[model samples]
Target: EGGVGYCGARRLKGGHLRGGTPAGAGLSYYYDPLPTNCVADWFCLEGNSRHLPPDPLQHPGARPDLNLAVFYHACNFNCLYCQNWSFRKATFSGGKVSAASLAQAAHERTACICFFGGDPTPELPHALATSRLVAAGVGRERRPVRICWETNGAMQEAWLKPLAASSLDTGGIIKFDLKAFSKEIHLALTGVCNSQTLKNFAALAARLEERPDLPFLMASTLMVPGYVDLEEIHGLARLIARLNPNIPYSLLAFYPQFYLRDLPVTSRDFAFKARQVALNAGVKRVHLGNVHLLT
Candidate 1:
């Protein structure tokens, strides 16, 4: 029953609380000041092409560049195959950053700023504040800066709508990493139920329909060899198709990492097969992400 409450003025030591009840029963959520090792990763330049969205790759006219600000460890889930598992070291020890200074990191070449991490939901206040500053051109001389998020999609609904609205206005994208469709398998993979994720995905898809021009929502799933199979992919695809077939679905190749290191890397054959399954399920645009990771 212990959960986070959404009061704008309520401040934690390092972050502010954006209130909402836990998506999972009996789970308690907490806020920490935003801790990050902000770095600009170039891979975002190649946006998701399989899904028709307004990304840097699609809009060449606007500066299609981005600054990937990786937030430090602080997630609601305990995913076993976390590739960026290093965040554990900094989850609580990393230096905290103010919203203003963090927003200032978006330089002239940066057309958009992506907030990702162990997950950004825990630091929603900081992310929201930083996004506001960027949109308002706090330090960038009134230049428009797009806001984007790569999240697990389990945040309270109270936080999700505002974040979605920010992305919609700036021609940005909200990518949800839908781990699994089955509740049991989802809990096994991420130590949480998939119910909130599925619910949130449906909510965002409805929001996308309101904005015909902007590709407001996208979804992805990691193909973790033995854990995530073709059957799971098909089920996920059907769910997405039912919401909106045009919603882009990406099947990512899994690499051995963290507790799942014993598992083999996702094979190219498996990735392609899953893509076909998704396509057959009526998802118009399906992509195989991290192709290079395929063995």
Candidate 2:
């Protein structure tokens, strides 16, 4: 189980285990042998203009290229509408790579490295190690290589503080997918309570005050038809606004996928309405993602 702990309490111990759900006296997290796939989906190497902080959008001429590393076969949540659901059956056998090897992938051209999943929480150790290696300037001069994370925001405080600190130091952003506002509906949609996620978000929001120049924190929600409606959007917006109205929130269009294929793709009107709801709730920066999926 050579992977990072979800709570950052420990590093992945040396072993041949692929992955497993482990818990301590009062702590719970997952451990996985640096799963076979290192980089799942690499995109926007030329720099994704949509990323927050408006650096790329504000200065199109100075766009910083980014590299996304999508880990496989590790997630704590069970969202029926999971677009990357295929990771559940993905085999990491003979596909695992060491932290140093993975870090090598982030060359000088890479301005940022985003660790996403299934969910990075389960593979926190590997991600952390890779981030540290990249930050140390593995091959190039000691230039900054932003370390970012897109996660469900359910990791314990023990692991989160350091992760946030790392991103804060590197000018990277940590994006949390707040599935839903209502606890009941959130459970219904993701098959897990969002209490921990919400708690972690509040904690991270407070941390953002230390580094205002960097868009260190972000939030997003999939506009699932019927499940995540205007009301849900408003509720989530208000929650985020309560902490910091400036916190950018993205309303994502949901496409019929996995176990939720019966549902229609999120409509353009719904996406717009969700944005309006978030704006009306006092959020200053709200936008729509996956617009192509909107009918």
Candidates in order have lDDT scores of 0.70, 0.71
Per-model TM values vs. the true structure: 0.79, 0.79
Q: State the displacement of the C-alpha of residue 217, model 2, in Å, after optimal TM-score superposition.
A: 0.3
lDDT by residue for model 2 over 1-295, one digit each (tens)? 6674432223456654334322111111222222112111112112334543445322444533445454545677889999887765543322455666666777644666777767778667677877787777643333477677889988777888789977888877788999999999999998889999999999999887887754688898999998998888999999999999988788888999999999999999888988988999999988787787899
Best by lDDT: 2
Residue 181 in candidate 2 has what lDDT? Answer: 92
* Candidate 2 segments whose C-alpha is farther than 4 A from its true place: 1-66, 91-94, 138-142
Candidate 1 displacement at residue 27 in angstroms: 24
